[model samples]
Target: MDVEILSRIQFAFTIAFHYIYPPLSIGLGVGLVIMEGMFLKTKEPVYEKMTRFFVKIFALIFGIGVATGIVMEFEFGTNWAVYSRYVGDVFGSALAAEGIFAFALESGFLGILLFGWNKVSPKVHFLSTIMVTLGSMFSAIWIVVANSWQQTPAGYKIVGEGMEARAEITDFWAMVFNPSSVERIMHVWIGAFLAGAFLIMSIAAWYLYKNKYQDFSKKAFGIGLVIALIAAYAQLVTGHSSAEVVEQYQPAKLAAMEGHWDSSGAADMYLFGYIDKKKEETVGLKIPGGLSFLTHQDFNAPVTGLKAFKPEDRPGSLNITFQSYHIMIAIGMLLISLTSYAAWLWRRNKLFEKKWLMLVFVWAVFLPQIANQAGWFAAETGRQPWVVYNLLRTSDALSQSVQKEQVMFSLILFSLVYLVLFMLFIYLLNKKITHGPWHTDSDKHSSRHSDMATELSKPSSQS
Candidate 1:
């Protein structure tokens, strides 16, 4: 009912929607690099075809991400003017750098990547792919530095006072390497890679299931599966390291994540089930003394609880954080299992024979998207009340002049528009996929990807 609430909802919905595409873009960028790199190294025509197919998908995703992301910038001036003004000095620089150091370079090479495949040399094309991948990562780095600074404010001093106060960066490098930046960015980038890898594997699995593009499917699927397994393991390690950092910097968030409410001694960590927020207790499965062992490797270590903080200082939505954290964990574990099993099947050279796993892989494309969303939900919701952690409460972050009706109207309008956009994306994607990766052998046509090849020898189609 409140204007601030409406504004928050609007920003959250639009940003979340915009977020969906970027990870796919980032992930797909990694996929593109691998595909094109192999094309250069091995002179495989299949790899070239795969690179072209992914280029189309990547371009589409990049277009949508750029379009949707512009809306968030407008919202900063409209819905969060006060918050923007407060941290403008610190945050604006990061965004500015993102544009200059990241977006410009990526966009400049994107033309070469998408269209220059036919016009340029293969080695040159491969170089473009690498640039795009690095650009995506650089974009993520600056944004992560900004957001991580909010979670763990450092390298800044408060200027002025009260309503007129603003944070000014005192040490630039210190701000860049703030306590949570590296860990948070590592987790985010890996998640993006997972999103991309699973998507490729999912599409490849579908082709195999339909008995279409067998050789193409096998190669693409194998590459994606290998990357998925490695990224899955990397995610586990980064998630653990991030948690350790959170233990030191954002203990209240860790408290909410594990659903631990005791003020002292060994704390139980809930693995699943419901949190009784009213009672500050968990109502499901938990590992006894898990919290203590997890954080300190000691069963008797004291973990801070919500009760330790004044009621007003506690995160507003403990239940959301608790549920989101567990949901993320559940999906992450499932992904590890699925990728591991796929690796086993491939090792035996019987992966396609398992129709059950083929079906699972086809549907598994949605898993990384879900897991990525859940992880973010846990992180953002758990850091609530304070938009800038301990320094700035979210209540103080809203635009003073914004009205509830204005935000609500925009929210409704944006939601409807986004829904249509989503339907269109799926429709076009299905159309492209249903047409198959490229022409079959019966067509007697030179492959569409032939232009992308610069090798001394032509690749013979296998199977």
Candidate 2:
């Protein structure tokens, strides 16, 4: 492969490594807020123990996320210098805002959340939990805003010409409210919530199956189940909205997603496929007019195809885009099924007896992580050939100073480094989990009774 290919591989590898933690951090942040809030409201020692146990995991993931993400910023300048200049104004504002508002806020309170359990009041610690969760969400918002602008650029005007051209924001608010930003941000948040919820469920399921921490497992399972269902359903809604936006603004990318080839008439959604790009045919089972119905609420509405665009402008690698998107959708559907089945069983109050379901949850923790990566791949590569959508080709965006060999060397080096980091993360996470929470059943009961007594001793006022 050439320098461009090497650069793409390097960036992809680093980003894939970096991505492993942010969603977990965001998801675990939500979990911390919920568990801590419950502890404060009910004064239950179980909730308090759960919050403390998860905060450690959150801190670990957040630390790793920060370390990995910093390299991407340097890559923008070193590997994609032209792109850096082209969109510097836009990305700078978004990323700077993220650092100032999101990262700073999260890091500031994270200290208190992780270390202030005994140092500060429970109310203060609970407030830290809320702030951390919001900060994680806000981190997601600005990042999505920047990326969404690339997918569907808005409120910006190109200045200069040719090699000197750059996009400058004409309307700051319009730039922030880019066409795809809100939908993408919501989808990411929902996915993060699902990831976090499944992680908790997996651990709880493991505990139940092993006959360890029975009370802890049940409480965690209940909360995780509710959150997973809410997020899973919300994912369906947000995913649909995102597709509609894609149909309107990036029809070629939409075409690649479904392997839709006709320039007019209805689009059929493929359930699965082997797309032969030269023949422009997809060999798969497809719902007739399914895409049209989904996008336009009409079975026969016209949907644009790749043929509508000039060959040069068409997104490269329809197969990669098609497969990645369909796989993401398949995983999403599976998540809904898995969560719904468990929810139905719980409604019958027979969930605990189902050892099979618990076993499934123990392995299903990887589902959302897989889906999130696949979705990310589809979103980025689907808009192929272009770094800034219609504005700049990825080939033109590469650093003139960098060579193929340099990128290749770094790629190999970083891959090995990441492998070590991944192993260490798993080992540490497993160790903490094996140790279990700090509280026993007796300690929990004593705390609960003490809380009740304190509540009873408080003076009642007649209003």
Candidate 3:
């Protein structure tokens, strides 16, 4: 394989693996704040227990997210040195802001959040949770801002120095509010919320199934179900808006996403399809005028197609984009249905007792993760060929000095290490779920020591 292909694969693998954690962390961080805030408000011990139990999981995810994210930074310099230099002026400031305003602030208070539960007052602890949540959100903001600029290429002046083209920031605020940033950030944050919400719902459902900590599990389910439903719904709207923006600014990508070969006034949205790239057509079920209405709010508005662009300017593999976009939308719709059903069950007071439904929830735990991954693939792969759209091709950005053998070796090493880490994460997470939070119940203690120590056992237990 070519070194560039190997390098791209390595980076994609590492990024996709690493991405699994951050959104969860970000989403769970907000859930933590809500849980803790309720504990402070209601003076409920069960809520406090829920907060303590999940805080440990949140910290574990945060640690891994930080660790894995560092590799991407190094890869930018090592595998794509020329690309890094090209966008350094724009990306550097965004990254610097992330460090100064997001990572540092989040890290500073994270220790206090983890260990200061008993050491600090409830008000102070709640404040810490809020700060951590805000910090995580801010971190995402800068990242989206940087990536959005790459997608839209705004607030920058292109400087041609000999053989290289570099971007210099002309307006910092404009860079922060790039055309794609707001919609992208909203979609990202909502996806995070869905990830965190479904995780909580799955775990809570498991606890209810086991008939353990009934009150705590019920409250957790209620919170998770409600938030998950809202976020899933909001995602539909935000995703639609984002698509409209893509259609307007990145017509080639939109064309690939819909597998549109020729321009039409009323485009059809494919529900499912197999694209024949050679034939430049898709064979599938489609909704007529759906694409036109989605992109332009008018069925008769002309939609651009891949054929309108020069072959060199086309974004990426049409089949990949088409499939990824459809899969993402399908999963998103499934989530909406599932979460809405969960909410209805909760409202009827029949949620906890439904064994069959609980089983479905257990299997559906990975839905948000799948949707998140598919959405990312649609966004990134849909905007391919050019790393910075028309401004820079990926091939031109790769490091000229790096050999194929070196990248291949690193790729294999990364895959092995990440696989081990993923297995370890699953093992630890399951162990935590099975063990559950620490309980102070006397019955549990007495059951443990009944045979050996009669004096240490108690007859009555506190609830």
TM-score of each: 0.96, 0.95, 0.94
Candidate models: Cα lDDT each: 0.86, 0.87, 0.84
Please rank every candidate by TM-score, starting with the best.
1, 2, 3
Q: Give candidate 3 regions above 4 Å deviation.
A: 439-463
Candidate number with the higher lDDT (2 or 3): 2
Rank candidates, lDDT, best first. Answer: 2, 1, 3
Evaluated at residue 279, the lDDT of candidate 2 is 88
Identify the runs in model 1 with alpha carbons over 4 angstroms from their true place: 439-455, 458-463
- What would the per-residue lDDT of candidate 2 be over residues 1-463, giving only the tens digit for each residue? 9999899989989998898898998887888788878776766667777887888788888888888898899999989999999999899999999999998998899898877765677778788889999999999999999999999999999998887788998988799999999999999999999999999999899989988988878888989999999999899999999998998888888988888889678888899988887887788999999988998899998789877887777778778788989889999999999999999999998898899889999999999999999898889888888989888999999999998989999899899989998998999889878888763233454444335535643544221
Q: Which of the two, 2 or 3, has more TM-score?
A: 2
User: Which number leads on lDDT?
Assistant: 2
Model 3 lDDT per residue over 283-341, tens place = 89988887888887887667998889887777656787788888889989999998888
